[model samples]
Target: MGRGQLLGREDGAAVFSSRTIAVAPGDDRVELGFRFSGTEVVVPDDARVVTNGAVVFGSVDCGAACAGTGTGPEITVDTSGAFGSVDVRTVTEAAADRADGDDD
Candidate 1:
């Protein structure tokens, strides 16, 4: 979602991509589908992630939320010999925060 954009409560899930996926504060969920090689998924550390059929090399840094007990929303991923790894970390609420040094 764009900066200052707020999702309504009725809004559905967001689709994940290979690039940097920035999720807004009100985003409730995200769906990740990997059907090709070199696919990497990045999500916030606070998100609740559930993966199936995925072959990841590196460990997901889910932190205290790895057990699907985070206060944030859910993130589901399904891969079949396509995804390389998933890097989990805290993502800023807005993409512009990275450029304006607000994330620091």
Candidate 2:
């Protein structure tokens, strides 16, 4: 993937046999069924974690007290048939602007 992008299965599986992959933002919609991953996944730092389960954002060393239904832009981690925790993060203003293609 690109410098600031991450792509993989909901359960964090390799999409291709190659270690290098390239993807860009798109307007496409993807529909799936009971998604589950057996591994940890990485998502955009600014994306919010929306789920009824636990969420670890900002730091991996945090405890259960840090688990929360996150704020900001929504990134649904829970689906109709799946419910679990996710580790997320925050992004710097400059990085967020870059992700939005705002170089100024």
The best candidate in terms of lDDT = 1
True lDDT of residue 98, candidate 1: 53
Supply the global lDDT for candidate 1: 0.43
Clashes of each: 0, 1
Instruction: List, residue by residue over 1-104, the lDDT tens digit for candidate 1.
Output: 31222222244222233334454555544444332223234456577766545444433333333477666667554444333344343443333445777422
* Cand. 2 TM to true fold: 0.27
Q: Please give the range of 10 consecutive residues that has the lowest summed lDDT in model 1.
A: 1-10
In model 2, pairs of residues that clash are 11-37
Model 2 residue 22 CA deviation in Å: 12
- lDDT by residue for model 2 (1-104), tens: 11223343554332222121122233111121222322222333334433333323211221221245334344433222232222222334334545889532
Whole-model lDDT values for every prediction: 0.43, 0.30
* RMSD of candidates 1 onward, in order: 8.9, 11.4
Q: For model 2, state the Cα shift of residue 97 in Å.
A: 25
**TM-scores of all predicted structures:** 0.40, 0.27
Residue 5, model 2: lDDT of 31
